[model samples]
Target: MDSPHGAAVKAEDFGLKGPRGWAFRGVGIDAAPGSLIAVEGPSGSGRTCLLLALTGRMKPTAGHAEVGGHQLPKKMSAVRRIAALGPVSGVTDLDQALTVAEQLREGALLQRHYGAPVRAMLRPRAERRAAAEARIASALEAAGLDLAALPKGERTSVRDLERLESVRLSVAIALLGSPGLLALDDLDLKLSDTERAEAWALLRSVAARGITVLAVCSEAPADALVLRTGPVDPDAPDAPQDAPDAPVEAAEPAGAEGDTKNDTTNDDTNDDTKGADDALAEAGRA
Candidate 1:
């Protein structure tokens, strides 16, 4: 059961244009809570532009989008409050010199300051400190990041962390404010295969806990709903194979040693085909 009021992102006929030309056109999608939708395309294929539009960071030249029931203003401040974007470029907002704990504390304080009523600021110092600490702890746990493991525990500088660790820390900071939607771009850009798998697993766990996630990638996991983009006539052969100035390479000899090797290997495999089939049948039934 999805929350009717949960973050439901809808983009209708979205389009964007830059100085050169259109970045994207006629893009439409509806993402509900708990859904993992992937946008897949080649480089310079407008994937990032579509992401920015959906997240409310950039407005579409045509059509409109709504996130968590809030329409994007022609401004950034309003959008900043409802969603968090993790860029594929791995640029976390964490201060390089600040420890993980300090970053979390600052994030909570900032959220409270911005979201708090003016009179709440007038409360006693102890009360504010307690409230901030509670929020930070909850957020860190929810993000699955243990600040205590850092070199200086919560006091370790972000500059000391490995790339993956830094990404996790950024996600923790984003979770502190309880955003309605989380958008990740270029999730596999620079990560190793194993690291990328770990990152995807982490994100799926986050989605299971009820955060709406939309990611952009050149390739996506098997379970993701894929949105693909490419040239309109993808199979058309546009290159001229018979152009007047084209170069040609000589063909291999008919009775070459390579042909003999392939024929011998094929004959040996054919002789074992019956035994292999029987083994495969037994394995399948068992």
Candidate 2:
């Protein structure tokens, strides 16, 4: 079945409340095929939670979401099959003891074993190994990852690699499965300007291949569809004010709609901040 976005994700009136408070309330979004929709907000503004909900990793308290033509709960398995999530939480998903090539090979084998029927699974072991190896190479190349550059090349242990390399490995693993919808969280959290630009280019390339990308970021990219949220004015009374500016402010949505295009362009060109890049390079070199 076709997804709400004609790709593989749809959320309507989705709400999630945590122990602290509501992460997102009455949030609704749709992503069409090949489109990149970005969710922009402050650190604690429920972007990650929303992403989890839409991806079927977390159930919502209210409203509905669909992935891959199946209603959330009813087709969760199917949704998972076609959706890939990359979250930056400092926790490596790869097995630290395993080499990069081993990790990739294992991922491909597992995907095949789970995705195919009993008959297909019964195929000769040699053929299966050949197919898995091919998939691993393709996924790595697509993500611009060069395992051979490591100290031990493809044999390099995950634990020995730099944080950025590990992150790239996770991205390669996610791409190995070829999911129709890709959800990325904190993509530019601590990367250098050059690294972030390269990452953005990689993401754009993935989207160009007809995948829908929904990412949560502190700042939105130039071509992203931006969505923002902020604290509601508690001191200001809800009652209508006589001031003309008050009416205009009330009429406009959060973050100001008129600034969308300008903000996008500004974000694209605002590369003056070299401090972040310096910090990221330090981290990468460490």
Cα lDDT tens digits, model 2, 1-286, are: 1121326566676654333334455666676677787888776556655665565444455567776676864444455566666543422256888988888877676666555447757889998777677777777776678977889999998889876676678777766666777777777777888877787787787777777777778888989876664442334332221111100000011111121111000000011223222222322222
Model 1: per-residue Cα lDDT at residue 69? 69
- Candidate 2 ranges with C-alpha deviation above 4 Å: 1-8, 88-92, 229-286
- All candidates: CA RMSD (Å): 20.2, 13.1
Best by the TM-score measure: 2
lDDT at 187 for candidate 1? 70
Please report, as a residue range, the 10-residue window in candidate 2 with the lowest summed lDDT.
260-269
Cα lDDT tens digits for candidate 1, 49-122: 56655654444555566777666434223444556665433223457877777777776676665655578689
